[model samples]
Target: MTTYNTADHSDFVRQLYAFAAHIRDPKKNPCPEALEERRMKIYRELFYNNVESFISSSFPVLRQIMMHERWHGMIRDYFANHLSHTPLFPEIPREFLKYLDHERIAQPDDPPFILELAHYEWVELALSISDEKVEIATINPKGDLLDGIPVISPFAWSLSYRFPVHKISPDFQPRAPEATQTNLIVYRDADFAVHFIEINAVTARLLQLISSNDHKSARTLLQQISVELNHVQADVVVRGGMEILSDLRKRQVILGVRV
Candidate 1:
């Protein structure tokens, strides 16, 4: 009997990886032409269906908004070309987001906010499954809402996109805003379902400051915004913004201060 040497074993392993890649890409396969054709039909159906299901569950609205052909084509392109970080099924959605962030699939004719909308759609599933646990610190929720704030939850993320993604609908297909920017807040609430909040520029900046532990007072944050929108009153802005912060606190989204 002949024994396979290390070099032979290595070659076999390399080919296995290559075969897996080819199975993933409908354009490539290692089997004989007739057999390869049959195998590919099964491979393509299973691979595409799994990814499509994962993405549909994560972004139902986005899936609904896209034409079936367009959605299938995008998923096929992603499965064949995008490099995934994990083989785990649950991680596929995150990999899909990573693919969108890096892949410039947005055509000029496509909605300007297509990528943002995809992300907005994915945020809910990502937060629902996020394993990161927040350690809520003790702080006086009633304590001067403006004074010496601590930290935001690691699980909470604030984002800005150039498109008003939240407004997208089958009827209201969005274009890039004339204003040039839109802001969003994605946070896990006490119930653990992710909530998406559309916020204005000032509130976005204030949350950014608080998240960064900038140690700035609410007045200072409003003043910073006031500098941009000349002639606006900091006091009025702070008062309005505090209401948001207070609500965030009540929801347990703001995880209290570090002190």
Candidate 2:
């Protein structure tokens, strides 16, 4: 193996980082004087355009709702400032979600539901591309959901947002949060189709319970929720929850009992 001089290696690494920084934010950082402007221009456009395209596809609705200047401005900020942890193109949206969640502060021009909308869009993309697979042999599909433990699918994600992100679109963007928080479950069905449905608080709580408990029967889980709610009729809560479980099973949100 041929080893290079340590000082030369360090200088090369520094030059490489400087080249990347200029490409990432050309307005703020100048490229090396030795580099050709035409070649650097191509690199800048190619890098920024690729990132922008992935982001546009991931959050199509959000893209449609925002003005071009505002949307591209946000994307540019993410491309320039976000320290993305992944090198894969598919994971770029996840990095953008992190930037919105932690790094980028909300601006006066940003939609009130910007973060929630981005998160909602990211869930659909995540479920579609997730590698988690269910083993059919381990699950007893015919088992009684109420009498036996029910298994929530890894694809069923329970999300609670301050705004109704599912309903936001170019035509119906709300300016303020609604009267109540919006609860939703986004899941992938047997056909590999991803779907999102608005759910009530009770249904969201039931999904949460199914996710956390491996031994509790559906009836027992419902009873716990009833006690938490201080409901006058525990039996009524159980009955309602059982019906909801059956519906969720039909949707493939509950994969079956852990048998």
Candidate 3:
């Protein structure tokens, strides 16, 4: 009887990955010849389509604009080159974001705002599925905005991007930055519905202060903002800050004061 080399078992795994890698990006790596061609082709189609579906759903806008060939090529490149940290299927979009952030380079044909737009889309999906919880019992839902310490909701995220990511589409691609920066808060409410709100620099700064220093009362936050903006009138800033905080609370962006 002929003895099969025991060492071939380890090599088999290496060969299988090599075969799949080639299928992912044939131009970058040659297909393995030892495997049956038809079987390899089946494996290729299944793997690529699985990854492609998730990417397409995650980035629908990005999908609609690109030519099918170019889009497939990019997806193949992602599958071949990127090493994802998570094995969970729902988290693939986040892994793709990491790939775009670190590994993938922007092609000449890709829009300048591709990264920001993808990030915006991912944020919506992320917030929608997030299971993080916050204490509601200790919070005073109708607390005074000026005197109470505002607690930011666990679901609230204050994001600043160079591009107006919410408005980006294939038809309206902007090549340069606008004079004003894009400041947005993406939050999930008590009903578990995610909402987006655009805020000015002053309000964004106030949220930043609240997040960074949870110990500070809303009045103290407003005072710090007054100093930062060099506003001669402190009371005016405090009054304006109250209105902003109250509006945010009504929208469930702020989960009321710590009681």
**Largest TM-score belongs to which candidate?**
2
TM-score per candidate: 0.80, 0.93, 0.90
lDDT of 2 by residue, 1-259 (tens): 1123235568777677767888888998787777898999999999999889989999999899989998898888888888876789899989998999899878987889998999999999999999997888889987999989998888889999999999898888889998989999999997889998889999998888888897889999999999999999999999999899889899998888989
lDDT of 2 at 25: 87
> Which of the two, 1 or 3, has more TM-score?
3
Query: Cα deviation in Å at residue 203, candidate 1?
Result: 1.2
Over 187-241, each residue of candidate 1 has an lDDT whose tens digit, in order, gives 8876777777777777777888776655676666666766777855767776787
Instruction: Give candidate 3's whole-model lDDT.
Output: 0.86
- The C-alpha stretches of model 3 lying farther than 4 A from their native spots are 1-12, 28-34
lDDT of 1 at 239: 75
For residues 1-259, could you state the per-residue lDDT of candidate 3 as single tens digits?
A: 1123245568877776677567767666666878777887787888889999989998999888788999888887788878777879999999988988888877888878888888988998999999997888988888877888888998999999998988877788888878889999999988889999999999999999888875778899899889999999999999999989888989999988888
lDDT over C-alpha atoms for residue 22 of model 3: 71
Per-residue error (Å), model 1, residue 140 = 4.2
Top lDDT prediction, candidate number:
2
Task: Give the Å error, residue 107, model 3.
Answer: 2.0
Candidate 2 — which residues are off by over 4 angstroms? 1-11
Candidates' RMSD to native: 4.8, 3.8, 4.3
CA RMSD (A), model 3: 4.3
